[model samples]
Target: TTQPPLDDESVYRIFNKLMLEGKVRAAVRFVTERGGGGVLHPSAQAEKRPPGVTLLDVLREKHPPQQQPCEEAFLPCDSLPPLIDVDITESTAERTIRSLSGSAGPTGGD
Candidate 1:
């Protein structure tokens, strides 16, 4: 199934909700998984932070740093890296389907 593209507003909404709901960790996971190119496409440097680094760390370093309650704070605006472009080529899907089919045959049922 084809996935619809997510807009910037949707991303911001998700981010805001995740933070407000005390699900920052879940928000981070959502961004890491879907926030790429067509998604959030957060800065690459954001990933350089140590493993123990909290989502706040990524927010502070990538976006403009700001001082606020830990729970309400997010990555700084300036530190936020530009979003990367995510291109989903048809060949990529075809290759994946072929691999999953487990047999190089016309039926593709195997």
Candidate 2:
């Protein structure tokens, strides 16, 4: 009796397992330089080693929530109007008096 052939996922899983065990020598032979020089084989005297960071680390770093300044403070107010209809009289007219005073308010040199 013959067993069913391995599927793509099974082959990939086996390859990854071998790679982790440093048994996939031929696959790991193509070591391209970081600065796009070219591929080179591991040195003859080189010892097999596991990667410094696992694939999980790379995926975590890539998919981590992006940080933004003032992100926590800026909550979306969905209850507020989608479009503002500004009326001059309805809006508070607090003309920043410092602009008129030519002091450049808080934004200019002393």
Best by lDDT: 1
Candidate 2: regions farther than 4 A off: 26-110
Lowest summed lDDT over 10 consecutive residues: which window, candidate 1? 36-45
Cα lDDT tens digits for candidate 1, 30-90: 8677444322244343455666666556777578855567954665565667899988799
User: TM-score: which candidate is best?
Assistant: 1
Can you give the lDDT of residue 16 in candidate 2? Answer: 77
User: Model 1 — TM-score against the truth?
Assistant: 0.29
Listed per model in order, the count of residue pairs whose N, CA or C atoms clash below 3 Å is: 14, 0
lDDT of 1: 0.66
* Candidate 2, pairs of clashing residues: none
Candidate 2 residue-wise lDDT, 1-110, digit = tens? 99796777876776677688876543343221122333334432223435465545555657978878686788877696579786765223445434332224444432
- Superposition-based RMSD of candidate 1 using all C-alpha atoms, in angstroms: 21.1
* lDDT over C-alpha atoms for residue 95 of model 1: 74
Question: What's each prediction's TM-score?
Answer: 0.29, 0.23
